[model samples]
Target: MRIKTLLVALAALVVSSFAVAADYYVDITNRTGYTIYYMYVSPGKSKSWEEDVLGNDVLMNGDTQRVTLTGYTNPYFDIRLVDEDEDSYTFWNVDVSTQDIVVTLDHLD
Candidate 1:
């Protein structure tokens, strides 16, 4: 009887471990003087830039925007930021799942 109970508990633990999913997030810090008018997030290896993740939003100087990324567990990503002057910077191969990400758009001069 005890052996059967132990087996059941072990099975439950295994199932729960598989169920565990860590929430992914990114916080972009705008340190540049210019207003960041758009933001884009895409898989590191993807050809397309995808949608504007910021969507009608602007990230200003000293502002921080935290976005929770769902449905993807990809370890790497490409992040892009566009300033008011329409200049864009694409930082590639950023390992999202492992990065303590605070992408500071420091300068565009």
Candidate 2:
């Protein structure tokens, strides 16, 4: 019976760990002096960008948007933003779990 209890407890711990993986959100503030038409975020190890987080919406300059990144365990991400002039700005290997992300002209790649 003790062995069975220990196994159950271990299983519960593993399940809880997975449940808390990347189950958080962060705010993305736009300070680049342009309208952001598209935004993409992918895992740091990924080779391509994920779907647009804006989804037909626009983030004008001086605006902030909350981006929820749930179900992903990876803390590092690659963020890309497209402006009204079709200019692309990329920020690589950003830790999106600890704090909000603020993008400005200085972030241009």
Best prediction by lDDT: 2
Task: For residues 1-109, write the lDDT of model 2, one tens digit per residue.
Answer: 9999999999999988774565667688999999999999888899999999999999999999998888888788888999998888888888877767899998876
lDDT of each: 0.77, 0.88
Ten contiguous residues with the weakest lDDT in model 2: 17-26
Supply candidate 2's per-residue lDDT for 106: 89
Listed in order, each prediction's TM-score against the native is 0.70, 0.78
Error of 1 at 7 (Å): 19
Once superposed on the true structure, which residue ranges of model 1 sit more than 4 Å away at CA? 1-22, 100-109
